[model samples]
Target: MIKIETPLTIDKVKCLKAGDEVLITGTMYTLRDAGHMRVIEQINKDEKLPFDMKNSIIYYVGPSPAKLGAVIGSAGPTTSYRMDEFTPALLELGLKGMIGKGARNKEVIQSMVKNTAVYFGAVGGAAALLASCIKSSEIIAYEDLGPEALRKLYVEDFPVIVVIDSLGKNIYEIEKEKYKIVE
Candidate 1:
């Protein structure tokens, strides 16, 4: 398994391809739909963002409240398409990677190519299992959003697969074409 560091660089992100299995280390941030909307709204207003966008990785999740003595609880990815409207702006702002489940829209995928970004797919319905990988969590912004608040997370070897690479290659599209039946 290829291990990647946080705050990914352009070269580091470009090295990855569609279908690569990766274990990410260091820090990442969480942003569900509400968090995304806030960030995008800030961008639209030309206001400062809550965090730096350069080489950033945003995981689409809204973790349940932490259980007693746990750092976080039942954290898993949400449907990525819901955040597509805000994705291109983030990518344009230098976001190098994203972690979530499901396919992205064509505009987002095309933006990934233009911006040299990648989308990683985490296993859906694996919230309980994935929580173990997040070592720590802290509310970073928009605390009023509750479960959808932005969070800074330090992760260790968090598992994900490259569903869409910087070059615009996509596993979903490739698999569909590969399995298409000839009439």
Candidate 2:
């Protein structure tokens, strides 16, 4: 499994092909619909953004509340397409990676390819399993938005499968055709 560090570049991510498993280290921020909207609003106003988008990876998630003694709640990836509206703009600002579930829209895919970014898929129903990989968690911005608030998470060997590559190769597309058993 490849281990990636933050401030990751398009060059570093571009060479990765689909079906590659990776362990992402360093800082990653979590955001979903609400957080994405706020970020977009800030961007539209030309106002300062909460966090630096350069060479960053944004995870699409709204985790469950953490129980006592836990670093975070049941943190798992949410469906990706909901954030598609805001993703392209963020990608333009140097955001190089995204982690989530399900397929992304054509626009997002196009943006990824044009920008040489990458998309990864984390298992949907594996919250506890995923949470085990997060080493630490802390709110970075938009704390008022509850779990949807942006937060920096420290991950160690956080596992993921490259679903879409910079070259526009998609494992899902190939797998779907493979499973289509034509008569």
Q: Please provide, for model 2 over 1-183, each residue's C-alpha lDDT reduced to its tens digit, 9 standing for 90 to 100.
A: 888877679778976899899988888999999999999999989999988999899999888988899988898899999999889999899999899989988999899888889999999979898899888888888999998999998888888899999888999998899889888
In the predicted model 2, the residue pairs found to clash are none
RMSD of each: 1.3, 1.1
Residue-by-residue lDDT tens digits, candidate 1, 49-167: 98899998999999999989999999999999999988998999999999999989999999999999999999998998899999999998999999999999999999999999999
Best by lDDT: 1
Error of 1 at 99 (Å): 0.7
Worst 10-residue lDDT window, candidate 2: 6-15
Off by over 4 Å in 2: none
Local distance difference test values of all predictions, in order: 0.93, 0.90
